[model samples]
Target chain A: SQTIHQWPATLVQPVGSPLSLECTVEGTSNPNLYWYRQAAGRGLQLLFYSVGIGQISSEVPQNLSASRPQDRQFILSSKKLLLSDSGFYLCAWSVSSGLYNEQFFGPGTRLTVL
Target chain B: SQQGEEDPQALSIQEGENATMNCSYKTSINNLQWYRQNSGRGLVHLILIRSNEREKHSGRLRVTLDTSKKSSSLLITASRAADTASYFCATDESGGSYIPTFGRGTSLIVHP
Candidate 1:
């Protein structure tokens, strides 16, 4: 069985501060990793996705960026956060075999930029 | 714009009753997936239906996909209070791209 872990389950950061959120998956190698953000009472928006280490494709342009430092480790970071950057950030993984595979998500991180 | 849109943004029903949610998408797709999310929690994948397939079942849940209409329906039979959650539909666009685009979701509340 595979498990995904994310931390600082909840975070409060002041505007203009640096941000870092980490996601790690165990029991899976070379999995496709993705980063998504959801606003209050809204649907999720894909921010970035990675096919392999050091390879990331961003879906939307904003204050955030993603990196795949290791095969099973993905990090979402920002040099300076903005108030609009506050949202529920999610990490997901899927098999790289097919184009239509189901994604497994982590618990998620709640970010509040005040 | 969102590729997929769920109907009836919110629904409330009594436990033991059947719950049905609909999703409509625009564009060719290789597959459609359904996911459930508890309040303040990450989403859990429920089921996936390929474009070539019409219907699929898992436990008490049934999903039907109509490729011609570009729509899908998810049916939960004998719903329970624990089944209260937001359901989202995602589409895997045709072509080799493996990304799945998600909709806003339909919030379902099952009263016990």
Candidate 2:
């Protein structure tokens, strides 16, 4: 079975500080990874998605960026965090090029920018 | 652009009652998926209905898709307090677009 892991489970970052969240997939190779943010009482906003190493697609322009350093390793980073950058961040992975595979989610990282 | 938008942003229902949430989307799709999120945790995939299919069942959950109107509904039978969570609908236009677009989820509260 495939599983996704994300950490730190919870984060508290001061304003203007840097942020780094990591996501890794187990039991799968060449999976498509995605980063999503959910504001309180709002819908999820897709931040970035990566198909392969060194490749990423930004869905929305924000203070965050994502990278696929390895086939199953994805990282979401921010040079300087903003108050608006706080939200419940999720990492998901799906079978690469699969006909109808659902995206599996990680436990998720709750970031609070104070 | 968001492909799905849920109706009645929030719903409150008593335990043992049926809970139904609706999702509307734009464009044609290959399938529509329903997901549930508890508190601030990651979402769990509930069910997926393909375009050719009209309804699907998984345990106590039922999903119906209306392609002509570009809408879908998730029905939970005999809900419980533990079932209180937010539900989201994601549309996959698998014809050529590989990305699955998600919508603003519907928050369902099942009070015991």
Candidate 3:
């Protein structure tokens, strides 16, 4: 079975601080990875997605960026955090290639920028 | 703007009562997916219904899709307190893009 993992389950950082969150998937290769942020009691906003290693796609212009260093390893980073960046950060993977498929998500990280 | 919108932003019902949630989308889609999220947790994929298919069943869950209406509904039978969470509907475009757009979600609360 495939499993997705995320680190720093919870984080509290001061404003303007750098941010780095990691996501790794075991038992799957060349999977589509995505980064999403959800505000309190709201829907997900697609931040980034990657089709393969070294390839990243940004859905909305924001303070965050994503990178896929390895086939199953994806990282979401920011040079400086903003108050608006506080939200539930999620990582998901899907077996899709321009085809509709179900996505599997990780436990997620709760980031609070104070 | 959100591509999908869920009806009855929030719902409360007693255990054993059936809970139904509806979703309306704005454009053509290849498939519609349902996901469940416990409080402060990541979402769990529940079911997916292709545009070509009208209905699908998974254990205690039933999903219905109407391409003409550009809408879908999820039915949870004999709901339990554990079902107290948010349900989100996601739709993928029929075009060449594969990214799925999600709605705000319907918060369901099932009293034990």
For the second chain, the TM-scores of the candidates in order are 0.98, 0.96, 0.98
Off by over 4 Å in 2: B94-96
Task: State candidate 2's DockQ.
Answer: 0.69
| Ten contiguous residues minimizing lDDT sum, candidate 3 chain B | B92-101
Give the per-residue lDDT digits (tens) of candidate 3, residues A25-107: 99987999999999998999889999999999999998998999999999999999999999999999998565767899999
Clash total of candidate 3: 0
Q: What DockQ does model 3 achieve?
A: 0.80
Question: Candidate 1's residue-wise lDDT over A13-102, tens digit each?
Answer: 999999999999999899999999999888889999999999999989888899999999999999999999999999999998866689
Model 3 residue B90 lDDT?
Answer: 94
lDDT of 2 by residue, B13-71 (tens): 99999999999998898878999999888999999888999999999999999999999
- Single out the weakest 10-residue window by summed lDDT for candidate 1 chain B: B92-101
lDDT-better candidate, 1 vs 2: 1
Off by over 4 Å in 3: none
Real contacts retained, model 1 = 0.77
Candidates sorted by lDDT, best first: 1, 3, 2
Candidate 3 chain A, run of 10 with poorest lDDT? A95-104
Candidate 1 lands at a TM-score of 0.98
- In order, candidate lDDTs are 0.95, 0.90, 0.93
Task: Provide the TM-score of the second chain in candidate 2.
Answer: 0.96
